[model samples]
Target: MSNTGFRVYLNINRPDPSLVQRFGGIAVASIADSMNRASCISGKIKPLNGAPLLGVAITVKTRPGDSLVMQKAMNLAQPGDVIVVDAQGATDNANAGELMVTWMQYRKLAGLIVDGAVRDVAAIRNMTFPVYAAGITPRGPYKDGPGEVNVPVSCGGVTVKPGDIIVGDQDGVVIINPDDAEDILGKIKDVLVRETKLRAEMPWNGSWVDEVLKEKGCEYID
Candidate 1:
């Protein structure tokens, strides 16, 4: 799969809108970096801040200095689509940048996830486009051939397949397998309900630990 290929094995339909909205951008996955805890890379650029991307994915496998397939991904991408590129875990060369992001924005793409670096940081940040990569760099990628797209690829230690629901935000990216959406949605809904009830209480103060300590006969010192 050294070209722009679409994964047909898992063309899961987008999650129900109501459920998607209820869950918001909450999905369980390990954070890419603990320091940048809320910086999630996958999000829906269009539909404004519309509950993140429901379901869509693109897998990329490229060499150290290659981005031919990434260009193809931009050409083939459609609205609500997410381009996921596996740059072979290379951080030296940038596989994506402002130009490709602009193309994706024009196509109404959701966002991009690359296992490598990307350039044009300032411009991309200013634009509505959401890019989740290892980091940014001034060094651009080479247009060499021999990169795969629309295949299973690992990004930031998460395996992604096409049509998988990629929910991300300032919290970081989470890959939900197509077959697991229903189950995960159930869990998410439960969590949301609990959170809602807890928020309504309004008596827990900023620190729940203080309440717990009081219950345990521990006094707070001024």
Candidate 2:
């Protein structure tokens, strides 16, 4: 299937939030990386720890130099939803900013993940809301021409559909294909269990790595 068609299918099939929460962030990232390497977007943008953002998605499509559609998205978004804008990887114009964030906060939305730039970094940092974008820009955006809302779009190099659960932290953003949510949840559970065991066995002295490497016929040179 074409990329657009695949995205459409994934969006219509919303993922189960209960299962997604069961798996958590680490598990979801691992699963998505294993299934589709391109699904992971690397960066340091994240949400405040313990922020309440779950089971929500706001899909958007905007031109490289337009912002009207994004504003419309903010106006139309409901509570407990994250805005995901596909700006076609535009890093020049700031499609989002403080005012938009203020509006989103008023609506009690989850967070925002944009494929373009955003302004008002300091304001966003102070707010409790989570926002992940490619970069920051001092220049704002021009609201003109056309844009779409509630449509499937790609953000942070990952394709996200409407109503998809978006979990963000210091790590980054990962998209969970709605149809595969259940299966991914099961896999993530297994991973979490295994990691728990490994965590317990890890030595406090930081010698666990050396021991494991020795077992693999490798030596650490001081």
How would you encode candidate 2's per-residue C-alpha lDDT over 1-222 as one tens digit per residue?
444411222233444556656545454355654454445555634443334445577788878757787777777676667788888878798888898888888888878878888889888888888777777789889978477777867676567778777765565666666666676666666766877887998765778778888899996679
Tell me the lDDT of candidate 1.
0.65
Q: What are the lDDT figures for the candidates, one per model?
A: 0.65, 0.69
Clashing pairs in 2: 68-143
Model 2 TM-score is 0.75
Task: Give the TM-score comparing model 1 with the true structure, all chains together.
Answer: 0.70
Error of 1 at 39 (Å): 16
